[model samples]
Target: MRNLVRYCLILSVFIMFSCGENTDKKSGENTVEEVQTETEIQKSEKNVILFFGNSLTAGMGLETSEAFPALIQNRLDSLNYNYEVINAGLSGETTASGKNRINWVLNQDVDVFVLELGANDGLRGIPLEETRKNLQDIINSVKEKNPDTKIVLAGMQIPPNMGEAYTTEFKNIFPELAEKNNIALIPFLLEGVAGDPKLNQQDGIHPTAEGYEIVADNVWSVLGDVVEKE
Candidate 1:
């Protein structure tokens, strides 16, 4: 009887330990699953800020991370802003071409839309009215997709090589669109960096990585207001 009792006690202890180990393994798996779910929820909660433009927006000669949009993303993260920056800028993209592709970019929801085309149009001496119309249509498309999406027009300028008359009119296009659409405007996207040989690449058009930093600042000046409201 004593030997039988001892064997029973040992078996009881072994069973308890086995059950405890199984419980701990199940608890650990649950914890891992919970963590993954929480991470996915956080990513889904972030609003998107889409930067739509041309070579300047694309960081032509620099790494994608060196672009102004990526810099803006860093700033947003530092400030604890819940926004995802989407760099939709394409090199050599003109306003007309941008209009065609704007719908595709709008496939996902966008809380903020920063329009940065027209520079290529100006350089190519494309008609100012055509440029203005294409931009307006692009803006309209965004609105139709999501009327609440905030629009920020990035104003651009070209040299007098296009003629003083054309240059003056080209500069006017941005403000006019902004006022007409009641959207925010970045007076000059290249404000401090434009025409500064040191800021530009060998092409004297696209900005270098350092120049994109200043560009990011210029963008945030106007973009900050829109982001804060969100």
Candidate 2:
């Protein structure tokens, strides 16, 4: 009888320990699964931004990876913001060209659009009214496709040599369009680097690597607000 009792006690203890280990293992698996699910959810909520413009947006004088849009992507990644930036910058593209490509660009899942066209138009001395109309249409088409997508219009100033009246008309186009469309606007895309020899490349038109930082800062000042809301 003593032997039987001892055997039964030993079996009971073994069974209890086995059950406890299985329960602990299940708890740990549940915790890991929960963590994975949360991470996926966070990833799905990330924002997608599209940069549409000409050579400036393409980082003509700099490496493809050093473009302002790429810099913005790097910054967002480093800050742990789940975001994707699409670079739709084409070399020597004008507002007309941008309008031509707008529809296709809109096919992507864009949450925010950074409009930076019209510089080439300004350079080519294209009619200001035509530039304005093309830009308006682009903005309208983008809104038609993604009504909720926020827009940031990157403005450009004509060189002073373009004549004061013409320059004023070109400079006024951006703010007017932004105001009318009720979108965010950056007054000057070049900002501190436009006339600075140290910041510009040999052509004096495009920015160097260091100059792109200033341009990035100009866009970021307006973009930061929109991102916060997103």
- Among these predicted structures, which one has the highest TM-score? 1
In candidate 2, position 177 carries an lDDT of: 98
lDDT string for model 2 (1-230, tens) is 99999999999999999999999999999999999999988866778999999999999977889899999998888887778888899998999988988998888778999999998888788989999999999999999998999999999997877788889999999999999999999989999999899999999999999999989999999998998888
TM value for model 1: 0.87
Q: What C-alpha lDDT do the candidate models reach, one value each? A: 0.95, 0.92
What local lDDT score does residue 55 receive in model 2, on the 0 to 100 scale? 94
TM-score of each: 0.87, 0.81
- Candidate 2 regions exceeding 4 Å error are 1-45
**Candidate 2, which ten residues in sequence have the lowest lDDT sum?**
39-48
Residue lDDT tens for model 1, 1-230:
99999999999999999999999999999999999999999998899999999988888989999999999999999999999999998999999999999989999999999999999999999998999999999999999999999999999989899889999999999999999999999999998888899999988988888899999999999999999999
**Per model, how many backbone clashes are there?**
0, 0
Give residue 93's error in model 2 in angstroms. Answer: 0.5
Please list the residue runs of candidate 1 whose C-alpha ends up more than 4 Å from where it truly belongs after superposition. Answer: 1-30
